[model samples]
Target: MPDFITLTGARENNLKNVDLRIPKGRLTVFTGVSGSGKSSLVFDTIAVESQRQLNETYPSFVRNRLPRFERPHIESLTDLSPAVVVDQRPVGGHARSTVGTMTDIQAVLRVLFSRYGTPSAGPATAYSFNDPSGMCPECDGLGRTVRPDWDRILDPARSLAGGAVRFPPFAAGTWHGQTYTNTTRLDVHKPVGAFTAEERAFLLRGRGARVRVGNTGGSRDIDYEGLADRFERLYLKRDLSALSRRTRDLVREFLTDDVCPVCRGARLNAAALATRVCGLSLADCARMQVTDLIAVLRRIDDPVAAPVARAAVDGLERIEAIGLGYLSLDRETATLSGGEGQRLKTVRHLGSSLSGLTYVFDEPSAGLHPRDVGRLGELLLRLRDRGNTVLVVEHDPDLIALADHVVDMGPGAGAGGGHVVFEGTPGALAASGTLTGRCLRRRATVKRRVRRATGGLWVKGASLHNLREVTVEFPTGVLTAVTGVAGSGKSTLTGELTAAHPDAVIVDQSAIAVSGRSTPATHLGVMDAVRRLFARSTGTSPALFSFNSAGACGGCEGRGVIVTDLAFMDPVTTVCPDCAGRRFQDEVLRLTVRGASIADVLDMGPEQALDFFGDLDVPEDAVLRPLRALRDVGLTHLALGRPLSTLSGGERQRIKLATRLHRTGAVYVLDEPTTGLHLADVGALLALLDRLVDAGNTVVVVEHHLDVVRHADWVIDLGPGGGRDGGEVIFEGTPRQMLTVQGSATAEHLRRTTV
Candidate 1:
């Protein structure tokens, strides 16, 4: 077998016809600034090509059912292996999907209980919540019941004639509302609150009465249905997804979720719940933290259950080894953070004995504490040691330091980037004249002078999630860093703080709504402004400049690409012939603002766009406001028309922060704003936070990067450890003061990073 996986003329995304040879069966860390084409090279080019080729090896029947991978824009790819990409995309499953089910540990536990439990469920399937025999009757194994929130749905202060029904569809003047308002069985002028107990029950639960609901057209006799019954029939009983987006959102506002009364959130039938081993039911085992579950599994001495127990323990230990021991098996996968979800995906592959495979990871260090990054590094090295080629697109210096080969791509970002500036060992790359190198060599010092709090926001007796009734105060008008290991209640505590202060603007790493047409211009709320600017210059309607509206290319309708479904074959996508991928009509393209068309402006980076508009004498605060905010977030190089779905996690996060910027005197709560950022970009982020503080905004950041903690005005460290061991504020002081504190994981890592 060849020792290298080679690629020549790889032009995927922003990559500049890149050529490289990555060593096989070794760890290669790809590093660069955000949007420097690191992901384009490692993920889009290498991984995509590898998976596409592997997909061809299977029969057409099998391949048709599998995920389709579009061939990347590359040439002469050679010696590729089957790839396993563990990306940062959230493990988004339904409410029934949990940690145990995701890891297959729940399946093993079921077998063990079926064989050795005191009162055994019929078979392994009988212990499975997804199985009809085992699932709870009330909640259908979902463990929770979503019911109508009567409080939100009804207005007690209003009479039937005055919009007693708070739901929009049932407002006073609507057809649905007429049934309640025009009915002679109830007093129309009486306030809902003033109604007698019988009247209230009749309003909410009465049925079988015929009522005349009329408008100017005519009166029709219809059977009167109770409000609760109507609501359940229309919204609750039916699949919420079947409703329109607006109706779904409205329905959600009037719905409340609670634990199932019959199963008490155990999600199992009585027979399954009765089955126990070591005096603990299968549900009990599923509820225990992974670390605790491992200990419990080790004590199972029954020969019949021993093998199953061992297999379960092995999987749980891998999860623990990856620094997620705090998570329970029953914990919903939907609630897992991006980092946790990525790690869980990694856990699935750790037990694989297959060799000669390419393991691809997209920033595995994201959402991890500095202390846990070392463990992640070890896992990568282990993958290499097991004779698999490990390719990682990373920014964490500690993780990069563990790489056998470092491939640094960039001299800049976007148009200015995509070249492989440095390729060598970690030590050599650090000394090289590259941005990644300079950042690695630079030393960050703790703030010498910290800002004093102008006021305080208190979270008192907060015990939500894993928090241990912890009370903490976040200082206002200062940049505060909330540092903790993953699952150490940092998010929970910050959540409570935001709950108390609802007006606080939260900028988090959660994904923005993205589609083929969703671009940086659209996301930053500047697309409309840009359209108006073009419209004013050309004396045309603003809609004429919008590809989503009047000016769309008739062939591709504004999408710029024509996707052709090939039935059993992989779907083919080609640039639209009419627009030539510009996504506008020829007439629209003919219109220009100072010699630049709308498409031309859309293609310009934020920095370039600002300059283009500035030369046109466009007001700075008009279209340029969001552009300035984008530039402030270190995304000046990002193209305005670039699809947001194509952006890296860090880039998306910065865009999110950019949208929420420029608001003064308001509390800004940011959850790991440094996620997906390059080391050099961290400096820009710190400066941005300082500006927010200087502008009289209270900035609280839940972060794990020591650099962010060091630059903070105040540090609130949570966790002696994660899960049950964490939650209390282990240290609360300036970064310098934290240097002397003991027993804090954040402080320990801080001391290590201090120059």
Candidate 2:
């Protein structure tokens, strides 16, 4: 019989016509250094094909309404099963999406409340805050009402022609700016700062008036609304994420995200709240941390509430296992970090009884501390033992240790990496000579002298949810680590501190650039220097050196794609056959810079690009500094032209760090910078932290990597436990001091390092 999932001659992207057989009901890990085509094989080749084929099973009319997916280039397949990819992608960006809704716990609560309690509501529907009958009358279902900011719109100083509006989407020369100035009743040249009482009130109040924009020899009438009011209608009421970045920033400058006043964050209507079970509303249960809810569930012995409470407890236990007990069910799904999102998704699959199915996971241990990693491992193994085949693309040692089989892909990333170098049991793979094997078999000792702090920042009376009058001091001009298990109030404390100091540099793992054209070179500001070098070396105008300018290949129009979104068919992103993915005209490629073309320079890895800059006669600037910093952070394997889409989430975080290196006298915050890194790369990243502190900037890092924690001069360890049992800083000291703390998970792990 064929293997449960057989991959034969699988010549997908970067793959070398591979062939493999995987068992149907065991844990198998895809291990390698990052960018080793693990994702290309799992997500691109297998998951996409399964989902695309599943979509095809639907009627053509129905399939047309769904997301389009292109079949990957592969030769053969057998014994394929339907796949459910629970990835690190945020659950939903819709303002309504919350943990209660995503997990369906709120629906269960609605049922429980409708059947039981004091002042009983009508039906289950009547108990749903999301329903109009249950929604708060004031805030509607959204629970939050956005009011316009008058100061952002009505400038009282400069006139309309002087660009006093000062907003991104409504600049002076733009269509919206012209419309406001051309209003017949309003004086165009009047300094907005000097506006009369009526003019100020009318302009700020969003009074709609018919106004002429630029004349076509005749007035073209359009509705003139206040910029503040127009902005609210356009972006504030809707999901700002759907809009482009430029538009989002313009609205963000004036809008403040606030809790809904009517629902008071209950996110439900008053009528629904009238129904209660055991003197507790559904929203009250949801607001409790997972750990706290579990306690509540255990105490409820009522026969009427028993079954529902048991199910809720089971779901909450799954969350705690995935290391998310600190999160409330009411927390918005969109607010979760990628690691948190990934783990939260795993909870849905944890209780599944389906056997003989292949469950694929991407980096299950990503945001987890070493203490939590063991739990993640247990969950993965539990899935495998439940008679399902578990395939995980991971770098975490704890997760890898639980694998029944390990397939190590690599020798490199991108064009250089593809073939599986080793495939065997964990012991055999660890004994092998591959880079992953070598790194796993070895370990690093903490430095004897971790950097020292010259000063510190003190936090007082800081109580932001669960943080219970917490006071802490963060070392200045050194690398201080906030070591904690998940949901240990790290984010709340750090956020409060950052908010207090507006100048603090925050380098989060948010997307660097999403458009296909945005590559590492462009995002890092290296493109301009590269263009100037090409211009000077080739004796041509700088515009001619830019692929986005005169050098654009006409056949592809510099996009390198002929994207045709067929109404119901898959959107095809085929390479520009005319330009052969070069993105520049053939004539442009012929114009060499020194010895290589502009594309060749872009093709160089960050390490190689550093040397090129050193060799060039270009002016020394902040550009080269960050590029070198990126290389030092172990991104040397990455090419400058590699699309942002192709980058791993960890690489994106490092890129964010590279961007913030220019900031001086500013406190820098890094959240899990070592995530998705190989053991070898972790050492390099740790060294980069030292360099950061030596430069006179304060670095505050939230991390689960023990190696990072071991090297920290001052470690603020949160959690005697996670969730309700956590939020208090249980230990604070140097790494040396933490080693003797008996109850601390971080301390125990550091002790093992000494051995």
Candidate 3:
């Protein structure tokens, strides 16, 4: 067997014909700037190829049913193993998916209950909420039901044709929306408030009602469903969290999640609820926190339940060892943060007896508190000890310090990056004069004199989540850093603050919903100005320059690619032959401004756009302002026409921040702004925060990075520990003062980093 996995002339994405070798059965950490090809190399190249090749080994019948992956752009690979990618993406499951179900702990509990309960519930299937026999008929095992807020959905002040229905899918302009307006049942011209109770009922709750809907040629009679009935069928029946961000937002505005009155959130039938083990029902066990559950399992001294209890206790202990003791077995999997989700994924794999596999982690330290990161390091080491090759693409220096080998991949970002700068031990890589090395040792000084508060926003009693009823004051017109271990109520504190201060601009790492038509130009509101500029200069209709309109390629319409669907195989996407992926017609391409077509302008990066438009004497405020906002947020390398869907969570957060940069006197609440940033870029982020404060804005950041904590004017450190033991304000002062304090987790970590 080969000692290493070798890649010869690998050229995926930004990689410049790179050749490298990663040692097998050892832990190797890849370090680089964001977009410097670390993900391209680790995920796109290696993990994708491994999974694709593994999928091909099965029979043709099985292969056809599996997920199809396009072959990577890499030239050659050797000594590859079956790879398991444990990423930061939330453990996405339906509403029924809980911590127990996801980690297989619940499955074990179900079997134990079936066998040992005073009254047997048939089998394990009879104790499962996912099973028909055990599921509560009222709630369908979801334990909750959607109740539309009539006040939010209906505006009685307005008529049906005048946009009385506020929900997007049923709004005045939509096809379904037009159906209501064209109906003869209720007077469309009259206000909804003026209608009789029976008329209102017909419009809202009508089931078998018929209506005449307008068509292109004429009107046709169709069986019509009421708005409420249609909404329940389409949106409420599905998982709200799994929907697109836009749809979720719209649903949240009008829908209320209430506990089902019949089952009362137990999610089990009467028979399953009746079955008990040691005086505790299966429902009770599911509701208990993991730590609490361990105590319950330990007390099970029954001969039949002993072995089952032992297994449950062992699994629960492993979960607690990785610092996830705060999480309950009943907690929804969709509610877990990226950090919590990643840790849970690692916990699942730790119990596996499998060996010789490649375990790939993408920034496992992301969203983790510094104290918990030590535990994470130990977990990674355990994986390597179990006779597996562990590869981590990371930015945390602590994780990098624990590596047996290090491969530093860049000197810069975007076009300036991708080549391997150094490959050796962490100590050697540190002294090798590389970017990652210098950043590892970099120190940020605490502010000498803290800025005074112009005003204060006080939270009298914030007892959300794990947070105890604790009162704290946030000073306006200064930078405040909220530091804590994972599950220490930092998010709870910040979330409440944002809710109280509705005017505050919140920049978070939540995904930005995007369609195929959405791009940087359209998102930033710059495409219209650019189109007008082209029209005015070339003396043609502005529509002629728009690919969505007259300028679109006749063959592929506006879309640059032609998708050819292959049944039972991977679909092929080829660039349009007519316009050759330029998206515009040949006539539109011919009309150029200063030797560059509209397509060429869209392809330019934010920095390039600034320079190109500046030379053309375009107004900076009208055109360059939005472009400069992107560059200011450290997204200079992003193409103006690039799809928003392609960007990472960190990139999406920064993009949202750029839109609000022009505002003043606003409270800016940022959640982990340094999430995907390179070590070198931390200073740049500090400088930007400094600028925000100097401009008289109040900035509050929930961060784990010591560099960010060190530079803050004020620090509010939560937790002597995490979960129930945490949520108290352990330390509230400057970084320098925090260092002098004892017992606080943030202070202890900061003290070590500064030294």
lDDT of the candidates, in the order given = 0.90, 0.78, 0.85
lDDT of 1 by residue, 1-755 (tens): 89999999999888999999999999999999998999999998889888888888899999988888888888889999999999988997877899999999999999898888978779888998998999998999999999888888888999989888989998888888888998889998999999999998988888879988877898899999888888899888776755676788889999999999999999999999998899999889989988998999999887778998999999999999999999999999988999999999999999999988999999999999988898888888888999999999999999999999999999998888889999999999999999999999998789999899998999999999889999999999899999989989999999999999999999876677787889998887787777877888789899998889999999999989999988656678899999999999999999997898999988898888878887665666657888999999999888899889888888888988988889989999999888889998999999999998999899999999889999898999998889988988888899999999999888988998897
Question: Lowest summed lDDT over 10 consecutive residues: which window, candidate 3?
Answer: 645-654
Per-residue CA lDDT of model 2 for 1-755, tens digit only, reads: 34567787776767888787777777888977667788888888888888887788898799888988887877876677778787777666576778877777777767667765568778778766677888777777666766655467546578877867777567677777776666676676889878787876666554658877774475577777876666667777677788887777777776666778878877777767756666778778888888888887777677887787788788888887777888898788878888888887888888778876668898878878788888888888898788777889898877777888888888876667788899888888889999889988886565568666788788877778767688888889888888777777787788877877778888766666577788877888888877888888888888876778899889888877677787777777788997788888888899996678887887889778878778677655645876876777667877888778778776777777777675567788887888777776687787877777777789998888888887787899887776666678889888788878988777787787653
Query: Candidate 2, clashing residue pairs?
Result: 129-268, 134-269, 135-269, 136-269, 143-260, 155-192, 156-192, 156-193, 156-194, 157-193
Q: How many residue pairs clash in all the candidates, one count each?
A: 0, 10, 0
Cα-based TM-score, every candidate: 0.92, 0.92, 0.94
lDDT of 3 by residue, 1-755 (tens): 88999887777667888899999999999998777778878887889889988988888799889988766777798899999999888787878889888888988888889889878879899988899999999888888877889888888999999999888788886778876887777898898889898988888777676777665777677787888888888888766776777788878889888998877888988899999987888989988768888988899888888898888888898889888887788888888888788889999999999999999998999888888888999999999998899999998988999999999987766667779999999988777788888877666566778788899888768999878998999989999999988878898999989888898899886656577877888888888889989998899999988888998889889788887767555567678999998899999999999888999998899988888898665666668889988898888877888778656556676788787786678899999989878887777788888889999899999999998998898999888777777889988888889999999888888888785
Q: Report the candidate with higher lDDT, 1 versus 2.
A: 1
In model 1, where do residues sit more than 4 Å from their true spots? Answer: 154-165, 169-249, 615-622
Candidate of highest TM-score:
3
Deviation in Å, model 1, residue 294 alpha carbon = 1.7
Worst 10 residues of 1 by lDDT: 614-623
Better of 1 and 3 by TM-score: 3
